[model samples]
Target: MSWRTARRICRPTARRRRKAQWRKAVDAVAGGIERASAC
Candidate 1:
């Protein structure tokens, strides 16, 4: 396989993983906000 093609394949996988991490972080922060408001 060409180097460029291999990189293109990897790029989306890396982006998806990063997006998943950001989502988890956002959920945790939102939960914290809710907990604080309840206090």
Candidate 2:
């Protein structure tokens, strides 16, 4: 496949993976805040 075709196929998956990581990070921060407040 050409570079452009490969990049088109790969880009969304990378973006999705990054979004998932960001969500997980946000969830972890929220959980930490809750725990701190509960203490």
Candidate 3:
């Protein structure tokens, strides 16, 4: 298969992984901010 085909096949999985990481990072930052604000 060509690189374009491979990329198309992998794109969704990569996007999901990235979204999970982004959500985790955002949640962590939000949690930290909440704690800091509570003080």
RMSD of each: 1.7, 1.5, 1.0
Ranking by TM-score: 3, 2, 1
Tens digits of per-residue lDDT for model 2, 1-39: 699999999999999999999999999999999999999
Query: Candidate 3, residues 1-39: lDDT per residue as tens digits?
Result: 599999999999999999999999999999999999999
Clashes of 1: 0
lDDT of 1 by residue, 1-39 (tens): 699999999999999999999999999999999999999
**Number of clashes in every candidate structure?**
0, 0, 0
Candidate 3 lDDT score at position 13: 100
Alpha carbon deviation, residue 31, candidate 1 (Å): 0.3
Per-residue lDDT of 11 in model 2:
100
lDDT computed for candidate 2: 0.99
> What TM-score against the true fold does each predicted structure earn?
0.82, 0.83, 0.92
- Give the candidate number with the greatest TM-score: 3
